[model samples]
Target: MEKWDVVVVGAGPGGSYAAKTAAELGLKTVFFERGRRPGDKNSSGCGLGQRWWRDFPEIMEALQGLPSVRKVEMVVINLVDENNRLRYRCGTTGSDLCANRWPHGMDGISIYRRDLDPFLADLAVKAGAELRTSTLVSDVIMENGQVKGVRTEKGEPVYAQVVIAADGAMSTMARKSGIRNRWGGGCTLVPQLDFSADPDKMDDVIGNAEWVWFGALYGAYQVNFRDGFHIGAGQWLREDWDEKPTDMVKKVLQFPAFQAMCRAIDAKPREYQAHLLPWLKKPPKTYTGGMMLVGDAAGFPCPLEAEGIWHALTSGKIAAETAAWAISRGDTSERALSEYERRWKASPLGKEHEFGPEFVDLWNSTIFDPKLMARQIQLLLEFSMLHPFSVVFDWGDAHMDCFNQHLEHLLDLAPQFADFGRTYLAPLARGIWPKNVKRILLSVKPRIPVLGKLPDNTFLRLVAKLSKSLAPYLDPAVNQEAPLPREVFERSRKG
Candidate 1:
C-alpha cells in the first residue's frame, strides 16, 4: 500500500502501543521494525515499576496469561563502598503499596526485551495493525515542510497521513522528520549484559526481586528473570566523549557485587548490548505538521533511573489518540497535530521531567559520601527495627519508651534530611509558589529557614505518615520475605 492512516516507526513498546491503539481506533496502521523480528535487537534491565502496572490495567491484563514476565516482590538498594564492600542494604517489599493494584499483588515485574517486545508487537498485530519486520525506515518522507511518510533503506517510499516516531533515543525518524537536530549532550550511554542460567538455580538464588547498585557506574541495576538476571549501568554522554561506556561497564562487571551475583547463579554470558538513551530534564519538540515523536525519540526517559518503557507506552497511546482525532476531523496540520504535545504534557509521564538537570543528577550523587549514607541507613534501620508498631508487626508492645527513643532519633535526622531537600529539591518545587511570593519566601528563608523546612520533609516521609494515617482505615499488610536471602544479598561485602 502506498498510503495509510498512520505509519508508526520502530516496533518497541511505543511503536507497538501506537500501532495497536491506532488499529483499534479504525485507522489503517502499520509499524516497521529493523530487526528480523520484534525484540530481536533490543536489550535492557527490564524492571517495570509499580506505576507501570498500577497505572495501566491493559498491560497487566495482557501479561496475565503470558509466562514471559517474572513478578517483582522486592526491590533492594545495595550501597557499596570504594573498596567494593556492600556497606548497607535498604529497600522495601512491594507489599508496602498493597497488592490490590499489582498483578497478583506483586511489587513490580522483570522481563527481557527479547520477550517483551515481541509480545507487545503481537498485540499490535492481533489488533489489526500490519507488522513489517527487517524493514529499516531510514528517513521520513517530507512534502512542503511536512512529514508525509517514511523511506526505507532499500529506497521504497510508504506514505501516511501521520507518522509517529517510536524509534528510540538515537532516532533516525525523529532527526529526519525534524524533531530536533540531534540529542547531542542530552543523551545517556548505557551498557547491558544478559545471562543464561539454570532456571531452578536462578529461582533459588535470585528469586523475583531486582537490585539497584550504588557506588557503581552512575546508577546500576540487576534484575531477575526466569532463567537468569539482567545487569546494566548508565552514564551521561559528555562533550568530549573521552571514556568508552564499555570500559566503564567493565569496571562494574568486576565489582564484588556483580561477581557475587554471577557466581551465585553460574551466569553464562548471554549477550552484550549497548544503546543510547535520552537523558533530558524536559521533553523536547515532539510534534510538527504531520508527525509526533514518542518514547526516547521525544526524550522521555526518566532523568535519574533511565526508565522509559512507561513513557513510551503512554505517549504512544496518546499520539494514536491524537492521530485518530486529527484524522477524523480531516485536519493534519501542525496546529491539529499539536494536540499530541498537549496531551503528553498533562500525562503522569510528564510530571517526571519537571526537575532541572542539577536536581536530576543529585540522585546519582550518593557515591560521593558513602559514610553519610551509612549514617542515614543506620538511623533508618534503628528506627524501623525499634518497635513492632513501626512497621506494624503487632500492637501488643507496651514498650512506649523504646518507641519514644526512636522517635527522638528520627527528629534529629529529620533536620539533616530537611537540609538535603532544601538544597536540592526546592528549586524544582518553585512552581508551587507565585513569583512575588517566592521572593518573599526566599527572603524569609535566611531568617526562618529551619522552621519552614519541615513541610519539605512531608514528601520524603510520605510512606511513614501514610501508613500511620491509614492504619485505622486499612487492614495491616502481611509482610513477605524478599526472594533473595539476607546472607546471599550480603555476599558482596568485603571480608
Candidate 2:
C-alpha cells in the first residue's frame, strides 16, 4: 500500500486543480481518472466563463496558448417562431460588460472538454501531482468512522491522509462515505451533438458568438469552437416530466433555428453525448472526517445557468488550500476539515451559489416559460417593425397605446406570477422579496422619464445599500475578512 498526503478522485477541473494546488504546496498528491484519458467521459456545450481568467490569471495565460480555445465576443438570446423565422433577438457584441470587467477584454472562451481536460490534467502533472488513468475509485477506505483513502476497482488500496472527491454529480465517494444519500429532483439532463464543419464557413456563420434558443420546452444552445461547434438541448427534470433526455435532444434538433444553423455550416455530426447536471438550491455537504468534496460532486454547479467549470475550478483550489491548512496543523478530523466549507461559503463561488435560486425564479417566470416568452417576443417584434415616420408625424400615440395595453396585460398577471415565484423559490432560497422588489422598481424606472435618465451610479448605490441590509438573511456565514489559520499562512508563505 502506497501512502500519500492527498488522494484526488476524478481528474476533471476540480480534481486536477486540487491535485495541482496540493502538489505545488509540497504535498504528495495523486490524481485518478477513470477514463483512458482525463476528458474521455466529459461533455459540455462548453463556454468557460471569463470570471475564471479574472480570478486565475495563470490559467488565462495558459489558455491563451491553446489552439482549441476561441474567444467569444457575443452572446445572443433568440426567440424563434415555430416556422423558424427569428421573432426576437437581443445580444451584446464588442465592449460588452465582460470586456469592461476583465482586462482580457472577452466575454468567455468556448472550448471542447477533450482538449481542455487533458490540458488541465497536464498542469497538475507539471506541478508534481502523480497522475493515474484507467483507475476507478470504487469506494472510500474507512475505519473507525473516518475516511482513510480509497479502493480502486481492481481491489488495490491507496492510503492517504485526506481524500478529495471530484467524481462528479453521481459521486460514488460522496454516497459511500455517507456525506450524501442521493441527488435532488432539480437535476438537468443535457444531450448534445458535436459537429465538424469548415472553419471558414463556421466563422462566417457564428462570428464569435454563442446562441441560446428560448420558447422551447428543452432550451437549446449553440457554441462555436475553433474547428467545430457543439449544439445541445437542456431540460430541467421534475418527477412529473418523464420524457427521456435523448428524446428531448431529438425534439430540440427539430427546431427550425437549429436546423438552419446546421445547414448554414454544413455540419456533420461527430459525436452524441449526454450528461447529468445537478442544480441544487444550496450546496451539499462538502466535508467530513478526513475527506472533502469539490465541484459537481459537491453540487457546486451554478443554480441559474448550470455552469460547473467555474465552480469546479474555484472549489478545487479552495479545497486544496483547506486540506493544506488542516495538514499543517496535523489534524484531519471532520472539525478541522469544516474550514473548507466555511472558506468556500465566504468566497465568490458562495455568493453566486447563494443567489442562484433567485435568478432561476426570475428566468423561469420571465423567459423560460414559452407562452409568456412568445408574447414578449411578439411585442418586441411589433415595436421594432413600426415605421419611423409614423412615430414622428403621427405622434406615436397608437404605438404608445398598444404598448400600454401590453404592459397592462403583463401587470394583470404579475400577482399570479408572484405567488408562483414565492412558492417555487422559497424552498431554494431566502431574502428574495427585497431583491424582487428592487428588480421591479428598476424595470419600471426605465419607463419614467426622469428616473430613466438618472446615472447608473444611483441604482448601483441603491443595490449596495440593499445588499448591506440583506446580507445576514442572504448568507448567514458572511466572514469575508477573517484571517487564515496561522500555520496555514506560514506554510503557504514557505511554499
Tens digit per residue, CA lDDT, model 1, 1-495: 599999999999999999999999999999999999888877744878777666676776576455556778888777665566765676675454576755457666788777789889999999999999999999888999999999999999999999999988888987787779877677877787778877777778777778777653445778788777767766667665566667755656767876887888788888788888787867778999899999988898887677789889989999999999999999898999998888887776766665546445565344223345445444435445543555354345555765666567778778776776777665444333233332443456445545555553342244234444222111223122212222222342221
RMSD of each: 11.7, 8.2
* Model 2 superposed RMSD (Cα): 8.2
Q: TM-score for candidate 1, please give it.
A: 0.76
Candidate 2 clashing pairs?
none
Q: Write the per-residue lDDT of candidate 2 for residues 1-495, one digit (tens) a residue.
A: 799999999999999999999999999999999999998999844788778667877886777667767778778877766455766677766656655778767667888888789988999999999999999999999998999999999999999999999999889999999999877666677788888877788788877787887654456778888778877776566666666667756755777767787899888888988888887777878999999999999999987878888899899999999989999999999999999999998898887776665666655654445556555454444444443443444444686785565556657666765675576654443333434544565677688776587765475455445664333322314333332323333343344
Give residue 494's lDDT in candidate 1 (0 to 100): 21
Once model 2 is optimally superposed onto the true structure by TM-score, how far is the C-alpha of residue 129 displaced, in angstroms?
Answer: 0.7
Tell how far residue 92 is off in model 1, in angstroms: 1.3
Model 1 gets an lDDT of 0.73
TM-score of each: 0.76, 0.80
Return the clash pairs for model 1, or none: none
